[model samples]
Target: MRWWRQLSVVLALLCGCATSPGGKPPPEGNGPPPPVPDTLPWTPCGRTAIPLGPAPEESDRGVPEMVDGERALFFVAEAGATGQGVWASRGTRGPGSCLVRVLSPGPTGLGPSEATRVGNRVFFAAEDPEHGRELWVSDGSAGGTRRVKDLWPGKTGSEPQSLLEYNGLLYFAASDPEHGRELWRSDGTDEGTVLVQDLDPGPEGTSPDRMTRGGDGALYFLAHFQGLSTVLMRSDGGPGAVELARVPSEGGILESLTTAGRRLFFVMGHLHDPEMHLMATEGGAPTLVSMFAQVGGMAALGGQLYFSATTGKAGTDAELWRSDGTEKGTQRVKDLRAGEAGSAPGGLTVMGNRLFFAADDGTHGRELWVSDGTESGTHLVMDLEPGAGSASPAELMVAQGNLFFSAEVTGRGREPWVSNGTAEGTVPLDELAPGALSSDPRRFVRAGEDVFFTAADGTGTRKLWALPLRPQGQCGASASWQALRRDVVTSAR
Candidate 1:
């Protein structure tokens, strides 16, 4: 598939409407606000909803990232039309201001997506008639939106992916005619943009994947040498990248790379024989931490790593496990289910000093659970669905000191909910879908004073929605909303 088409598929999976695949939530919980002037679109709780294009031509499915403190950058695309490209909000809430303004509008659009903010600028990959899909940067304005470097120069792009901000620089994997697909970093300038290293050292580059930053400010990634081996390498952006470990040809797959403190953790080998390995970010050989039949939801908290797994070589039940980068320290936090059945805890997110995830005890089907690195401290936060029914909380994220996620209940199928690590403090926001249906809110991103997300409403059309960070004030009567509406009326006269 073409690069842009591949990206569109990934975006659809990431920002799925209705239900997620396999009837389960993704491993991570991953939004904005506004009131309205008379000319602007509006919603409840000082919120704003903007629909892009007409009907079938929906707004691009992805979370918008903040460029500065006020403006947010997003993309709009139609299946087979033009006049869509990079867009941004007017950067002010209370006024007769247009909610959004186009940064780059064209017949084919810019194909701008996968945005990452470095300092005050957002960097992304955009395609145009001239340059296929190269790196572009924006300061949330049309004048500021421009290409950083033509790496590949002509119509064929460098095809940059895995954009990450490391040590104040934007790092990504791109394919140039000379470098194949190697590691490159940019300081957001043509002169500053340069190749960091050549891993494979030929026309067929290493093609690094699973790029992760260690706690010690080093870049760690997996470089597949095609017919040879998959090398685990790290670079400090100096001379070259250091290979830490390797897996020979089809032995197994290395995946789930993460870090905690100065230790870099990853799982090597394939399913049913996965081995947890840890290497010191400073320098050392890879150490075997533990073994598991099935594992996922690996997260770091308080200098320790936590995940879900089924111990030994064969098991179907997966339970919560934590490791201090050692075999003895790597053990299950609790056997939540008591018998052969496992709690299968996943989406392990850190809020305050606790870890929150979704797990199933025998009593309650699958509900919200929390832990503090201990068996006793690990328990259900609330039975959101009450009885045997599972609330199936997905997308657990911490924004502005609270936990935000999506959960399904009796009256509400699946909707956005927030929590303070307690049952009473946990509650749902305004019903976006209403009735027994769900908007299936996902990809919550906080920008300025609001959180933005894409969700379907009663009309079942997915659009960008913004909600205040606090969401405490009454609907439609917030001070900001009233002021914004008044400004629109005054400006009309």
Candidate 2:
């Protein structure tokens, strides 16, 4: 997905319905039976907080690069006052859990977005007063943070994007002024960091985007050949990137490139075309699974690929779907909202034996829904908001066997919510901000026993926060009926 809830509006427009980005529209018929609220209110997570400075707004871009040597996550975060640089976190809850060492101190930031870890060092792009924003590498410490190479030296940065790690090398696309935009590989050193081959000769580069890794240990990316033509290209550590196939680009389509099993799966179609096809990278000429399915987000679970797609078919439109890489295998999982109301599930995530997503099944509005890969087994997990106004779940990430997402309650705004797929297990981390503002947590990166993330403070400025999660591989299915009967009472209201 490009971001969150863009799929909601896309689905609404395509299916002739009205589903808000933050909430759901009322169904045609009567709503479902009113849910019996449990007694307990919002359960607060007694977690320690660390101030990693100011982000000013919620950016779903704080990436956590794994530093294997220190068993920590090396990331770019804002700290102190207007200082954004490389910082490391070991994922512990106690003192000194957060490490704030500014690698490049600047007013705006070091501009480290996609930092990829190779051998314990993270390679990323950081801003420098002398040299704009260029490629830099860090070893999780101050002394080790430095630029790898100035591809376009002296403030004219080779602004790089899509840091991909494979075969002991880092691959990405950078815009070198003379060479245009081309693929480059690095071995985490200055001498080793050099341009690979130029796909599109000079300044008017191929403009590679959506760089994805396939099952066969090769890179699959999209590049603009002329201008209107979008080509699917491949590079197998070869002499240069080559065009694999030509993809139709009517709406800048098929960016959700994901590797499911041995094949790379993504969407392909224009905006108004209801015949959006779900295709794979391999399997001979790309199989078209659905006639009108625009898959927004996908997750591989239980050896099958599950995604949220807008099928434009009544209740099944914008609901959960799965594929076995075959036309017969690809079908809507369930008509979750009955006949033709549209459940419209998004944020597809898999935990343990079930698939968890945020859906409005006409009855429960927009709450958490879970499935066992069967229509009969797919049902509502809990009603967090309890009415047509939804607690829409997006940015679903799994940490310590539980699912964490951003949800909006009436008074709470949108905050970090934790759920183990149950009524009582679903709750928000209720910590006191400055006032009524939300600690809108996003960009979760799990390292050791902690999840490092960013959240908006009471003053509507973004800052870093951490939650010490349960141990990895621990089953998070902890919701007693007595507990649900208690928490649902006040929490649902």
Candidate 3:
């Protein structure tokens, strides 16, 4: 069976679109000011919709990452004639931008995933009918592009994942008949790219995930063992990889691991008894940080850790909390949902001196909120959804000091939104699909003044798009498009 997945074209996805900023309801007699006249760096490249397979009905999912020293955005784009292959763009939002440089050509459709940059090269998991799926490397050119190794042999792919560069080696997980699915490393060579260890030993695989860095030499990750147990483990790209701790996972899972100030924090337990803990390594016993109802999204800001957790007590509610990695310093920032039902703040992100997230303050449904690590200062940015529902802003990210995310409007599905942490400043960046059609933007990558993300057309074909995040004057409606292209090309380049 082929491992590649195509978006279901016939499936109608009720998603959101991204409109321009400051698109709120104005005073009665007052009309909307003329649309901001200036260029957005958003360029549409490749086939907006794939031709060979089912297109994504909701989102195209263009995950733009820097290549060639951050000079351009490289991502997987599907074109009808070119099939699915790697593409590079200098932040061009125009159509067929994938033609700028077709990094990997697959007439039978190439599928790429787990892309990561190691120094000057981009390593990823790519699939061709002949090779199945294996490790490939590219230096943004045809001459430099080549296959690293075919670990699984043929017909069966090693299915490389958790690709990360640590201690001067590209470490990932691969599955062959011998090792099952264990740890593997590559120095961009066939012999150098051998099995790091068979942690699980035999057929039953111990799938290592995350591939996070712990300290000077090794990297920390999570791997599963016999009892379906999730364990905290570390590897130095060799047989020396050791299991740090075995989580008593009732549901056979360790929620998530996030790094903050030299410590790794995670949660454990089943639905009714989740606890958060902090660890310096996979070494000693982990220190219990909190015994909250549950800890979901978390982010580190200004040496303090912030996350959304529910207080499962009387009048229990979910709210934002912060800590100096101590129980004493840990407390709720604000009662967003108030009473028993939690506001359930998630998607914590940092911009400037504050952290922005999405939450439902009893009144305006689930909307955008920002905090300065204090309760009084934590407030809603605007009523994006307006009533008793959620605009549900997600994927909170920062680029050039501005916060960007995707959220739903009343009639719009989920669309891209940008904010400067003010009521008037928060608005949908563009109506990509417009009306009820959702563009469903994802994978925001910032380059200079522009923020790049992937979006699907109304037909659900994913492609690359960019938006100039910094404020600019109106070049007027007539000149805005041309001026934006020129300025963005200059600034981004």
Clashes of 2: 8
Error of 2 at 187 (Å): 1.0
lDDT of 2: 0.63
TM-score of each: 0.79, 0.78, 0.76
Off by over 4 Å in 1: 1-83, 90-110, 249-253, 270-282, 470-493
lDDT scores in order: 0.65, 0.63, 0.61
lDDT of 3 by residue, 1-493 (tens): 0101011010001001122111222111111124443554322121112111122112124434333223344455554465655554433221213322343443334466666777556788777666667888866555556789988787677888888888767888888888788888888877888888888778877878877774234578888776557887866667877777776546434456666666666766654544434333334456666667666777878766788777665424778888665678778887766578888888889888898888877788888888998778998887776678778888787765567788876677887766657765565654667678888877667642246676775667655565533334322333333343333333211
Query: Model 2: C-alpha RMSD to truth?
Result: 12.6
lDDT digits (tens) for residues 1-493 of candidate 1:
1322333222223233333211123211221234434343222232233322221123254443323233332343333234435544211232111112233432245455667767666788777677777898865455667889999878877888878888778988898887689889998999999988887777798777677888777788888886688888888864478888887746444455788878888877633334534333445667877766666778998999998877555566788888888888888888898766788887889987899999999798899999999989988898888788898999787865667788988886788876667776566766788879999876666543445565787778665555554333424344344433343323211
Instruction: Sort the predicted structures by lDDT, highest score first.
Output: 1, 2, 3
**What tens digits encode model 2's per-residue C-alpha lDDT throughout 203-290?**
8887776777787667888777657777777778656566656755566556467787777777777767666677776733555666
Which lDDT value does model 2 have at 103?
A: 48
The C-alpha RMSD of each candidate to the native structure, in angstroms, is: 10.5, 12.6, 10.7
TM-score of 2: 0.78
